[model samples]
Target: MPVLSGAEPFAHDGSEDIGVLLCHGFTSTPQSMRAWGEHLAAEGCTVRCPRLPGHGTRWQDLNQTAWRDWYDTVDAEFDELRGRCRSVFVFGQSMGGTLALRLAQQHPDIAGIVLVNPSVTTLRRAARLLPVLCRVVPAASGITGDIAKPDGFELAYDRLPLRAMASLQQLWRVVRGELGQVRQPLLLFRSNTDHVVEPVNSAIVLDEVRSSDLTEVVLTDSFHVATLDHDAPTVFSGSVEFLQRIHRERAEEVV
Candidate 1:
């Protein structure tokens, strides 16, 4: 399948010994994380943002994919980054965050993790019916472009593939169950007024993750897609600062 023009995956090999793997959300493409990846690259961090298995092509393609397929893509990228850098970090937005957490659970050596409005569970009554609804319906209304900035937009599918969504729910259950295994340093950026993901999602993560170093920043000016919204600068800069602090602490430990 031909990748979309702007949704293509991207990579940067930096001079620094830090590697960062970025993951975009469900039904979204690497385009959502492109700016953030570039920012990290400019800061001398090696960066890789891979297009998720079913994303960036068409909505129908997603229906044929499962959560494992998406994880395999990022998992391979993480291995590549680990092989090339002295330290590595994982950054994710929305469902991307769920994948990041799964990575941390499986790889104890990940330097740290950064998440933006990560979703592990939803309070929607309809979600309970995904297992059955997905079998009957092929797709549903899209949950994209939830940005507070009028001009901000994500290059994502306009429709939600039901089977893919059901798979995502399965992924959420697995991640939430293993949250205690995530022991790396963590930074989470959450929107104060997100229309897509509810506040309970972040609350559940903070409470369940066993990470000793956990920090959360609330974005008052953005919605679900905070990466491309008004507080994007805050998300970008704060992530850099968090990464630097983790790197510095590791260096001091080696001294």
Candidate 2:
């Protein structure tokens, strides 16, 4: 089933003609993408960073939801952005990137994508063991340490919901298999020092996409959460450049 363009479920009455929709990684909230969204907004792009169905408020909330719910939330947010802007782009981090891949596949109108450490491919053997592990392990938090912030502040959400991880695995399977279905331009930024998701996952994405226009950036100084790492400024600048290039192309198309 495809997510068609229409009125957004959420209200965005004061935005400009260009919109960018952002999604956060698993066990994380919209706060992870808040700065990215705001920066895009400051550049005159209408940004929508919605809390995935079971995120932001509590960890247990994730266990109650599945990947479909997460995709639906992003889909509706995309619709909202579409309603207000002439052009829209989808960007995400980690599991959020998986959802964004689904969006790019189904929503052909999307201008392009900026994927930051997208978890399209899980760690070795974990993808194989997910089915049994999810059922055996009860809902609990697995995120081990405090997510290091951009300002050197630490805000940690120390809860690992097995069900949520399971759902994410399911999404990964779907997106991983459907990578060739994505034909839009793509930008991939990866951290070589990422402690969570393996760097090879980015390699998998670049290898699978059928899109002829693709750019990749390696973040050597960052960790798993590249958005707030030492190279965060580079991530921001690169994304903005990608958006600007796409925006310019759209302008040329219009003229």
The C-alpha lDDT values of all candidates are 0.95, 0.77
After superposing candidate 1, which stretches have Cα over 4 Å from the reference?
Answer: none
Error of 2 at 29 (Å): 0.4
Candidate 1 lands at a TM-score of 0.99
Worst 10-residue lDDT window, candidate 2? 1-10
Model 2 has an lDDT value of: 0.77
lDDT top scorer: 1
Model 1 is weakest, by summed lDDT over 10 consecutive residues, at 11-20
Candidate 2 regions exceeding 4 Å error are: 1-15, 144-156
Error of 2 at 200 (Å): 1.9
lDDT tens digits by residue: candidate 2, 1-255: 221122112223335667888888887766667667767777778888877776655566777889999999999999978888887889998887888899999998999999998887666576577667868875553553223444542232467677777888788889989899998889988887776788778888899988878999988877777776777788888888898898889889999
